[model samples]
Target: MSGAVWSYSENESVSNEVASAAADVAKGASAEPVVLEIGAVRAGVRAPGAKLLLKGPATSDVPPEVAAEAIAKASKQLQPAAILIGATRYGREIASRLAVKLTVGCLSEVSKLSADGNALAGERNAFAGKVVAKVSCALPAIATVKVGYYAAVESAGTAVTESDVGQVNPLVKVVSREKKAAGAVDLRSAKVIVSAGRGVKKKEDLPMLEELAREMHGALGCSRPLSSDLGWLPEEHHIGLTGVTVKPDLYLALGISGQLQHTAGMKDSKVVAAVNTDKDAPIFQASDYGIVGDLYQIVPAIRKALASRR
Candidate 1:
């Protein structure tokens, strides 16, 4: 309540999202929201109110361990009331280390955050999303905000200050950096996604499902089995609890059993539609529109419907 609430993320896009989360929490506690930038300030990064640049380590990139050290050293002087980090792998490590260094509480994968003068409160899905758990920590705490929950802030604040936190060494040395495949997809930003499930019989049939997605101008996604077990698609395309969370305009689930793990990730979609041969499939319960039919027969019909309109 006495100090500013900070937001940070190693990823550029996720940083803006955390800014929005921090702003909401700051407003609840009557505090200012500040976005923290390490190494160098990024033009794409935004803050709901103010921004802080911590100079040290590499100007381009630094390991999470080194980043945690820099933030901990700087925080000793500035002393924020709360620190919100995006729930990215790098941010998770940084937040955990920062909390330990500061000897404060750390909340993981929480959203719908609030500040109640003395504490920070938020909600998190637990038990594979079968239950929503309410969790909180006292002020001067650290939290990792869930992705695909908050919209990214549109404007950047002009009030910014820079501090030299001093250079720090990394525990793990970088060997080499390789670019991802040319057409890698980020399902987080996709407006429309068609996800496959165990109902898909063979890997050879994947292109047919992919074609269906392309016909609807949507990206192809899958459940854990298709990606993890079958290796039909990369893990990036997997939509589930242990995979990526998506909040698309439309999420079409094909042959996916409405398992809680799978539904948890896509539950935030604006509209959900599912096609399964079994009328009692759990996926139908989570869908806005449910079709009790075979996807093999249904997919061609949907494609034909689209072609007729074109």
Candidate 2:
């Protein structure tokens, strides 16, 4: 309860975000915020706190298992009150492993976090994101901080302390790596997003939505069904609780039903609009504007309206 708050992430950007969250928690606890960097010390160098560089053979291109081992070893030595990890795929694995190694509780995908005396309280979505639950764990806890909940922070020049953790042989060896197919746009950074859903009907109908997105100078996104079930779009385009989280300025859900799983990802959007044939669809509950009509019919009308103004 009296030690520093620790944070780590494989991605530099996410690491920075976790650092910010750590700093916030540490402030309330009156403890230092420490950043742990494996493989390389790049993220810790820019983080706004003390940096612990765990250097070793296990540090090079550190796999999740190796990174978790290194972190667990470090945690045993430092005995931090709490550890904040970015909730990326690998980060989740690392958090779980660390929790087991340390024999502490772990919270996954927490959007809001704070330090409360000897415990840490976190808020996370539950029941497919239809409900928000407040959860708490005693000190020496591990929690995966949800992405986009906190922005990265930078501090004036801070020194990093390097410690050699030595070599670690991983159980899982990566023989090859292949990049996922890249999308035409990065939906996370887009100001406007036109998302499709199961209502899209077919892959051939995607062009219509794509044209709408292009006309609005936005990117095309989709629900999990479109990407995971139908394969009409790549997984990169999917936005949901299990997929990418986005906070666009304008989120236009076209033919999307607005399931809790899908809305959890884009609920942070500044403005939301939905065009669906079902007037009673769940998507309307989450949207700021609703058009109860067929997207096939509504899309052309919107295009015509925009054309006339031009």
Candidate 3:
């Protein structure tokens, strides 16, 4: 319980955020916070405390299975009180495997984290973001911190230590890697988001929403249906529990039905405005401002109103 806290993420930026969260936990518990980096440590990484670089054959572009093995080995020696992994696709796998190896509980997708006595406590969305559950586990537990929840800390002067974790033969092998198609917008950093949903009718109607987004100085986004089901937009434009999670200053849900899966991604938005024809739509319940009307009628009026203001 008195040991240092460890944080790791496959993504450099996300690792920095985990480091910030770990620092906060360490402060409350009066313990050290250490950032664990696999392979070569990046020069840009800034941890609030110390950095531990794990080097080995298994650490080189290591798959989750191999990386988890190396981390478990290091953790056994370090005896960290808690390990925080970024809640990314691969991160979840690492956390699960580590928890099994350590025989400790794993908390997934935790947004708010804190030190609870000698144990770790966190709050995560449950029931599709409809409820926030407070979870706690014994010391030596593992938890995946939700991406974008904690800001990356700046600690350019932190100490660094390197250790060779040794080679691991992975069960799966990566044959090749290819970059995904880049989108014009990065939804994660967008301050304002105008998201379309199933009600958009057809692919041809997207340009209207795109124009609205441009007028509002925001990026175009869509619910999973518009992206995965209808293929109206690229997968990167999708926002939901299974897709990208976002926390923008303003989220405008146009013709969205507000399924729990969709709301799960944007519930953390500072302000939410929704337009729907159904008065009892679920999106209205989650919105700070709601207009019950057809988007076909409302959108044009909104654009005209903004034009007059200009």
lDDT agreement of model 3 with the native: 0.88
Tens-place lDDT per residue, model 3, 82-142, is: 8999999999999999999989888888867888887788898889888889998878789
lDDT at residue 136 of model 2 (Cα atoms): 91
Question: Candidate 2, residues 209-294: lDDT per residue as tens digits?
Answer: 88888988899999999999888888889999888999999999999998888998999899999999999999999999999999
Candidate 2 or 3, higher TM-score? Answer: 3
Which candidate tops lDDT? Answer: 1
Candidate 3 lDDT trough over 10 residues, lowest sum: 54-63
Query: What is the alpha-carbon lDDT of model 1 when measured against the actual structure?
Result: 0.89
Q: Count backbone overlaps in model 2.
A: 0
lDDT by residue (tens digit), candidate 1, 1-310: 8788889888888988999998898885668898888888888885557789898766847778988998899899999999998998888999999999999999999999999769999999998888899999998899999987888867755777988998787768889977655666789988899999999999999999889888888899999999899888888899989899998999999999989999988998999999999899999999999999999999999999999999
Alpha-carbon TM-score of each model against the true structure: 0.95, 0.93, 0.95
Report the Cα lDDT for residue 209, model 1: 86
**CA lDDT, every prediction?**
0.89, 0.87, 0.88
